[model samples]
Target: MDVFRSMQIMVRAIELGNLSAAARELGVTQPTVSKIIAALERDLAVRLIERTTTKFTPTEAGQRFYERAKQILEEYADARADACGLSAQVAGLLRVNAPLGLGEMHLHRITQCFVRLHPKVEVELVLNDRFVDLVEEGVDLAIRLGGALPASAVARDLATSERFFVASPDYLAQHGAIEHIDDLQRHEFIRFAWLESGATVEVAGPDGSRHIALRGRYSINSALSIRQSVCDGWGIAMTPAWLVQDLLDDGTLVRILPRWQAAAQTLRLVYPSRRYQPMRARAFMDYLESEIEAVPGLTTSRPRC
Candidate 1:
């Protein structure tokens, strides 16, 4: 038995929470993954995984071993990279995760260009709107859009984002224009269901700041859907500048509060904290930075220290 291969399989299975997912990631049959895991358990003489009909979980011992195994794998990757002169070459599978709207807009292009530059590298992009744990999901990195992140997360700021309230021209024409912040309450609102904000929204305008308590009939989780609704004249919605810039220019959506500013967000690249880093992941991040800087809205023209 190849102990190294089995360890890799065992670690993937635990991280993915299923044998089939691990197999798919590793490009092997499900039975092959199961067989390797069984051999690993037999050799270790411990029950590492607790399987059930609904789900699979790692035992306490399994959790401890999994953490250590991940460390070992990282260290091995670094050492092998240096030994094989792979420090200059990026050749490996790179799995990336990001929000659906952002991914659809630019991440595919980013990955495509990176692959073109490094033909030896394989890329996987998973666009999801829900929160994902990088370690548990076996993700190499994630593109996150938020104001602040967890204290323990390792992240790099890629750009600054500004949010704006927008609506279709026909909707605003029919519903009456919002002359002041107080007028927002009178208009129909489209709310993002996953957003933690309460029913009320506080806005900062040219004159001052005020709060508007909204009673939106439409609530959705997807930014794409919200943009569509706003374009279709459903209601006024708020979104980042990057996601709706095209719509704004093409006259599909119009900015509602030009003087009133919404919350700003930071575009970030987040990863699980670790002592050693993978060469491929690092290379890809560098490539991404270069690619993002060229895009007009993704990043600013200012230099970083």
Candidate 2:
């Protein structure tokens, strides 16, 4: 028998002055209440109540037990309230995981603001290109850039990343500007090795859309490395605009096809789904959503060719 439940039913029966009323309050049948009362009496080896037809009254000993049981239930409620409050409070170490380049480029700024807004939270950001098991690694949150989610992954998309065809002015000056989409084939291409099968860039013209394969002379795995290579006059590459926004503004890098771009990336805030997320993680996720919009070229529509 559930001791607490038995005690609660006895207490409610005494207060309501009727077994039927107590059963109604508890959302249980009258017979169920009678069974609990009987079990509780057997467990205590004492008759707890005097019953007559539709009315009930607690015995002297039952009065004492009822008072004590009420206190126990109140204490339990208080403890639960405290536990829920602590679970929702933002005051603990928040371990976060994210891809290297995106973390360094954008997330750090938003996190900096989030910590300032919530000083009690201590953040540990682990930046890596490889995927980490959120449960095994004990990560509160992860920001994944343009990647497929696992079968069991739970994620909230925060923003879309725009990929721009960027190259340094020096390289364009040397090789000459690409006058048309076909001109991209005549030039050596800098590729991000992680792209794998997606070496082709889909472009839209007055006629329709087609994929232009980047004939790679150089390939890099890191977004930062790819941006560096493009800036260093290695070759043209499709890079996330936020990663090279300053370069684009300063003309160190120029957007090759203003009208055309590769597919936009879906940036997601990922986490393991089991229980309610910690307050710090939830707070940071909300903060990042608002701050990410400020990144240049993130919402800017493509220009006409």
Candidate 1 C-alpha error for residue 242, in Å? 1.2
Each model's C-alpha lDDT? 0.82, 0.78
Model 2 poorest 10 in a row by lDDT: 296-305
lDDT, candidate 2, 1-305, per-residue tens: 99988988987787677888999999999999999999999999998888887557778778767756755764565466467775444665677898888888777877888888876889998998888877545576888877778664699877676776888889999999987888899887887786666678776655478789878768878889988888899999877777888888887898887777767877788987744555566778877777777877565232324
In candidate 2, list every pair of residues with a backbone clash.
none
**lDDT (Cα, tens digit) per residue for candidate 1, span 1-305:** 89888888888898778899999999999999988988888999998999898988998888877877876886788788889887677787788999898888878888898899987889899998766777666688899988466564699888877776888999988999977777778888998885777566767778787676877888988878887889899888767888888888888888987998677767889987876667788998888877776554565545756
Model 2 quality (TM-score): 0.68
| Cα-based lDDT at residue 49, candidate 2 | 88
Alpha-carbon deviation at 239 in model 2, angstroms:
1.2
